[model samples]
Target: MDVTYPSSLALALFSITLVLALFVRSLRSKKTKGQLPPGPKGWPIIGNLFQMVMNRPTHEWFHRVMADMQTEIACFRFARVHVVVVTSSEIAREVLREKDEALANRAEAYSIDLISHGYHGISFSAYGEGWKLSKKVMVTKLMSPTTLNNTLVSRTMEADNIVTYIFNLCQSGSMKKPINVRDATLTYSHAVMMRMMFGQRHFDEPAEDGGLGPKEKEHMDAIYRALDCLFGFSVADYLPFLRGWNIEGEEEEVRGAVDIINKCNDPMIRERMHLWREKGGKEKEEDWLDIVITLKDDQGMPLLTFEEIRAFCKDVNVATIDNTMNNVEWTIAEMLNHPDILKKALDELDTIVGKDRLVQESDLCKLNYIKACSRETFRLHPPNAFLPPHGAREDTTLAGYFIPKGSQILVSRPGLGRNRKMWSEPDAYKPERHLDDYSRDSMGVSMLEPDMRFVIFSTGRRGCPGTKIGATMIIMLLARLLQGFDWSLPPGASQVELVANNSNLFMAKPLLASAKPRLAPGLYPKIQV
Candidate 1:
């Protein structure tokens, strides 16, 4: 029953329909098996694999499947793997929180292994000492409050640059400029993380430096290349033993990208190790690179190899930068586009900081409204609408239902955050709900204080370690920007929707936006907050 519509989208849909038809025929022919959780039927050999891979927003498709099947939880099997999509908060907690030890492991694909430099990173690595040591080093050293405070000058300078850059762009009369918030946010995140981790940066180069050194360019380029290949569809991943069929030139592309990334980190890792060796057995620098380079086990032996060190450098480059940058940019976009929310943020900042200083981590606590705003933005535009697959490592019954080992379990933030049953007025943008001003009780705002049901940064042990740093940057950047300039969406582009362009279940990339800044100079440069 394929309809001959004369459109590319329709033609593509026909391919989907043909795939569905083949799936249905196979399902009917093989009705002897026990009931599998509900899902869209697909072709015989591939099952629904093609359709699932083709659809960019797989979360939405999962929701549709759930609705059509009227099931709270459904399992979609791909090859020998079973991917269980949990729709309700109770079940999500059951898997991600209660019996978390078994389910906290990541589902590692072969391609991920290839791109992650043999899965050395914490994000996709198997649950082991490597993950433990890497996470510990990052959480304790690189992202601690002390490091954040010590590096306040650098963060403030970047915040200052953001303000000055916006001011200059406005001064150029480019009010209706296509200011790609993605790129802008990426720049800020890259600089902040790079400076904090390596004491080096690649932004706003001086004349003598000639606009960023070669190392900085190589660093950014390699990181981007690694990311590009990390998400690439390698045939080896699908059929690792058979090596299905590598796309033309894909091997070269993957190797080149991986080499670029490995080369970028080797020098830094080597330099940090050398610096440590010269300290004469005394305590070395407590920076991230220093910590990883010197981390020794109980026997006082270096836990990670030189290769793992480079891999970890790439890991920090991705996990810390990608979401934090997008989150900051999206927060700005949401605030500027929605006047009521912008007014609320401005009023809160003015009352506390009062145009006297820029917002800082110190102000993060006292500014309840600002915190609520950050939480609400995370709720609505969760940098990653879904966390990476947390594998079911053991055959266990979750929520009193049996889940087999090797099943790929998915926890969807979109379904949970937007669920009407869970949130009152789930569609509105209100931060007051999270504030304890029970005095403002009649505003119909749903408070987000101490709740994991929304699962923006996820829950339990495997949750994102950089949540505080990431969210704090968004609050500070947004507060600082609002301090300097009033923003409005550009003419004709004012109403653009804040839609998700997710790179995968684990990454939330925002849509491009155009806007105008209308603020006076010297207003946002104050950064004592």
Candidate 2:
């Protein structure tokens, strides 16, 4: 059954095929000459798939490529898919503002489709009435100011728990040794988010039967895995001819991740529903889960189906925790790396917050410098180096370049943050720039708003719904840590790692830093709550 060609014959065939492919490509190129943006010329069938997938993380790689290309917008083909990356804030504005309606839909990803119950969730849903309805419910009902105000006490309690844990560590004579700041932030952020979402924080604790604790860890892992797979480059997705092949085993992995998430979330949704019914629908909506189970839509039907509710819950948790945790960790690492900056933050805390009591969420407004530092951190290390993939709804023109329908558009968040033309001394860590103008604060200006150059939370219609909660969590955690302790790199370790490594999406390395109590002895005592 084995039929083989001679080596010379095989080589000649490949050469002829390549020539033909190039000839065909030239014919197509002639029609769109000077229309498409400039980019790398890739091979016949694979295009830039090898360059994209072979690289550790495409975001960082793309940034470097963009720099080399010296163009704000670069276009290339990855397999059969057309990709457009926008680097400058000006182009980002055009894509997210001027042409938002035409570019509102996210690129289709098999993994996200499964997790979102066939695009039922708001994040990946196409731009239409269904998306508007879902987004309205999420913003107006689930994460409105009222809901956030109601959950303030629980969030504070979680913050207190973090302080208590650190206090205990100091008490046990672990102050001189470096602590895993990343792990601590993860625990704190997850606890805060869980309490707000599910009305409990016990998931972060150890249990005899290995109760919700183990399940919580598993759920977090599954969420991360799902994100990685959903965003990870896959050949089948781009090249339709290969859909059945499962070249990277992504299909199976995505299914397993979705199953894990659903298995953990389904029961929680059921319990919330059962409780609502058992109380004759009179149970006070204590948390997000309760609200979703009881709230009705415009049609007088349930706001979300069982599947949609679980998907929404997963989205909220992952969105809120991941960004808040990373922002806090990065902000702290930045301060540790710069003693002058750290001193300024500590001085601000002492002057405004004082050392008498722990920093409260209420104090966030008064801690202007601390807020600036956090914003600076976000500018430097956004939650994602690139905006979530967006798909063109129809043929559109972007920055004077033609973009065909369904082309995937990515806004380079990293490039925007470090844009030399926009920001002076762009690579330097200076929080003072933000402090220069507090008037923007009164206008409700924030990183989430379109006017801000930094688009970590994204822009336009599909912006993150958890923006307020995320901002609050980061500000509060940073304020508390700065107020409660004096932090520094472990002795002799001078600088914190700034360059993101290949492994993670946001953070490059784990933050290892020493913490010493700055508060009075009595103030270090755990809150009685």
State the C-alpha lDDT per candidate: 0.63, 0.74
lDDT of 2 by residue, 1-529 (tens): 0112234433543454466566456454324424878788776665776566555456667777878989889987875578998888888988888898899988776776777887877887888987887788789888899988999889888787777677666667556888778777877876777778888765435533212367776776677667666666565677554454555667677778778878777777787877775556653788888887887767977767777787678777567766877788888988888889989989988887788888887777777777788878878877666777889888889889988887899887767888888888888889888877567448322445465477657767777877777788888888888888778888888688776645344566778888888888787645432
Error of 1 at 108 (Å): 1.9
Residue 517, candidate 1: Cα error in Å is 7.4
- Please write out the lDDT profile of model 1 over residues 311-362, one tens digit for every residue: 6777777776655655566677777667788788778777877765556656
Which residue pairs come into collision in candidate 1?
Answer: 23-42, 433-447, 434-447
Question: Candidate 2, clashing residue pairs?
Answer: none
User: Which candidate leads the pack in lDDT?
Assistant: 2
Relative to the true structure, candidate 2 reaches a TM of 0.88
